[model samples]
Target: MSTLPTLICLHGGFHGPGYWGPLVSLLADKGFRSITPHLLFGGTDKPIQSLEPVIEQVAKLVAEETSKGKDVVMINHSFGSFAGCSAIKGFTSKDPSKLSDQNSGKALGIITISGFFPEHEVSLAAMAAASRTARGAPDPATAPQLPFKPTEEGLLEYDGDPVHSFYNDLPLQEAQKWAAELENMSQFVFATGGGVYAGWMDVPVWYLLCEADNMMELPQQQSYVKKARDSGGDVTTREIDAGHSPMLSRPVEVAKFVQEAVASFSR
Candidate 1:
């Protein structure tokens, strides 16, 4: 609300904004405004994870912050990248709103911690294709033997654990804490409609890739990053030598990378 750069952090599946707790404190220590709104999918006991509800929650938070005169720079993790894109497009765009211009000149840029960027119109067809063509498949932590059948108990296993798959790189305590607060994750957030979907903001884009990410192989993460660049989005990419969850495994280094990204945006 101080007309300063407000960094919005979005966590991925089976995780909440609490995952951003350390980084938020780090950012704030440096005179930045960092926010982590709870995503709806992380804390529920239900087996299904829908993206729409959480998307709405995030959009509302961003809009509220913006209305209070804060410029938002969204930093999304894994699946969170896709969710944030959808939420912003819906909340802050003008007519024919295919893109978000959140804080190009007014605030920092949109930084993706490493996730998918989708097409607009929210098409399942496109999302399905991406999944099939996904460079590195995102295997369900516990895929049902029946293929289409997912277990409610299996859902509870992950929801109850406190550390999602990608965050396997973190220390035990940190991982569990993150997983415990997670709620719902809809199957829809993964879809990619064939429509012309653009971010509702013009904030510059930065993708931080974990060179050793097991969940999304480096090639796959690179593929998505390349797509973002090709789409005329201003994107900068950096690779780290850690597993998928660099924030937990390498918090200090992650913070340093973010600091650099923020400075780059200022220029």
Candidate 2:
């Protein structure tokens, strides 16, 4: 019997591993092992102001797991995908000398759920700019900024209501419950952008598109899918009939897709 790859899940901005509970529980029921790390840049008690450290943290985890001879399958959501991809770069670099002992791992596949997958040399900021241009909105540089507030310690908090944006498909009470738990994410992560790791070029990738996602519109998600394919990624896609937070609104479907992705890794 083939052992299933260990699932290393990375949650979206303003979220922690806690956000993956529903999906993880389902995977566990099916006899799969999973680990969801709390990213330093997101819901941690101490805030991380940059992306590099977050990537390094994830890389270390991947290395630790793979060093035990465990194959890994990384799953990422929203902005978490950036850090996940970076970790893959850190691990599978062609130049072995450049990789740290704690940053080496073997990844069997990558699964992105409503996540951003930037093309080479294209940052998330650049993608946002392109999205605005496509929508005929004013240039992002000149557009009015969101109503985010910076703390006394200089951390930016996401003050926008997520109900309409992320939890539109959830029941009213359930949406309110999760919204109350949302944390502030680093604004720096959004302002900075860069190309994804070249490691993704050779990995099998599955993109789970949320068709009704108001947070990342369907058109924008499709653009990322195209970029992934153009960059030589062996891309497979599945569309979910839910909003942005599918793990919450449609856990069973997400779990089934995850199972399928794992099964494809061996074939």
Tens-digit lDDT track of model 2 for 186-220: 76666665424545564788899999998888987
| Segments in model 1 whose C-alpha atoms lie over 4 Å from true places | 1-3, 45-50, 90-108, 123-125, 131-149, 152-164, 171-184, 191-197
Residues 122-228, model 1: lDDT tens digits: 54336645666664655678542221223444342232223435666777786666555555544433443422245623456778888867666788788776776
> Which candidate number would show the highest lDDT if scored against the true structure?
2
Model 2 scores a TM of: 0.87
Candidate 1 — worst ten consecutive residues by lDDT sum?
Answer: 143-152
Clash pairs, candidate 2, are 123-194
Model 1: number of clashes? 27
lDDT of 2: 0.78
Residue-pair clashes per prediction, in order, are: 27, 1
